[model samples]
Target: MASTRPLLLLVLCSLALADAHFKVFNLRGSSLSSSILGHADAYVKVFCGSATLGETSVRNNNPNPWWEEEFTHFKAQQNDVLRLEVHDSDFGFDDFLGVCQRQIKLGTNSHDCFLEKGGTLHYTYTLG
Candidate 1:
């Protein structure tokens, strides 16, 4: 009976920590900062904790960049923190535009993160 109790508890804990699918899509930016020459070459990186989920392709010379892309993390956990970073693809060092961090939640989630430097990033995500 004692051994069976431990086994049942382990099964319950495993179920509690089961993996969930996470998807981030419809990522767009508005009124982003322009470079000295002209508009910014923008791209985005999506992360779950230290793991890199995916990255968007760079949109050159566009203040308003819309990425028709989706990033998915198949083994995401509910307690994980999601980090979205916007960057300018420059010649030498890439410029850090802004970043948004949010706790993972179940169901659909949306955020209109105001960038640190200048701009707004709109994105929608789902966890199931």
Candidate 2:
């Protein structure tokens, strides 16, 4: 059986729900040391393809802070890995930190993807 990360990005290719997303969390971490689940106090924006799926603005009901506003209602294909581009509030794209290991439902149909409840999927890049 294939691990969930790579499969997340590939699953979308078969289904054309929308082309509004681009990057996928490609950080392949199946253990604790390589997850992207942490806290950042910066303001940023998330792009789905060319469309702004997440922002610190009121339009998307963003509560500010990059993390909270970004992953809200976010969805992913079976193995769609999102390349996370972290940016500064007043600056441009800065770095690629981590990835979101999806934990959706068994019968999930919507584009809305979220980590499973109590299901551990680390979204980190590296552990040092």
Candidate 3:
């Protein structure tokens, strides 16, 4: 007699290999505390793998700026590394502020990662 176990295993494996949706709700603390006196024109760049997925608008000359911008990517995979880079827009060349990366997973969550500089960027992420 033939068994259905092998077919079931294949179906389960396919389900487990499905891609996930990743969403960035908002980001805070994009600017350094030392910039309290001088404002920073900050924006965020998001990268997954070799592709640059999303970015936020520049919060002009504002330290402790809040970006309530939302980003949704359908190609996000489990255990994928997501990187966020902050930059200061200038006339000629943009200055690098900071960057952080974290592993992607299922379900709704939040994370605070340290930037290359002595600054902190607070952001919330959800994987569905």
Candidate 4:
């Protein structure tokens, strides 16, 4: 009976701390011309809380870029802040374009928000 009690407690604890998985589908709008030449090679950086999630492929010479990228199996909790930053790719240093942030909440969600400087970013989140 004592052994069964421990096992049952373990099962309950596992269920309590079970991580949640979600998908973030993002699309970005035109960024202001920041390239030294004229057009910008832009990409996005995603962050969950303070941890770096991942970056999208660079869209060269396009101020307006559409990313069908999916962040699958991302671990997050309720009320966590998800941030996105737009940057222009460069040889030595990347130029910062804009940023957007949103808070995670219960249920499936979708948001269309503007970036920091110039441009718009939209996100569709599916929670599991």
Cα lDDT of model 1 by residue, 25-95, tens digit: 99999999988988889999999867898899999999999999899988888878999999999999999
Q: What's the TM-score of each model vs. the native?
A: 0.86, 0.26, 0.80, 0.76
Clashes of each: 0, 22, 0, 1
In angstroms, give how far residue 76 of model 2 lies from its true place: 2.8
How would the candidate models be sorted by lDDT, starting from the highest? 1, 3, 4, 2
2 or 4, which is superior by lDDT?
Answer: 4
Specify the poorest-scoring 10-residue window by lDDT in model 2: 26-35
Tell me the whole-model lDDT of each prediction, alpha carbons only. 0.91, 0.31, 0.78, 0.75
- Rank ordering of all candidates by TM-score, starting from the highest: 1, 3, 4, 2
Give the backbone clash total of model 1: 0
lDDT of 4 at 102: 81
Residue 79 miss distance in model 4 (angstroms): 0.4
Which regions of candidate 1 are displaced past 4 Å?
1-17
Candidate 2 positional error at 20, Å? 15
Query: What overall lDDT, based on C-alpha atoms, would model 1 receive against the true structure?
Result: 0.91
Residue pairs of candidate 3 with colliding backbone atoms: none
lDDT of 2 by residue, 1-128 (tens): 76898787778754655322323222211211212333222333444323354543311222122232324233433333333333222224433223333333323222322222211222322110
The residue-level lDDT of candidate 3 at 113 comes to 73
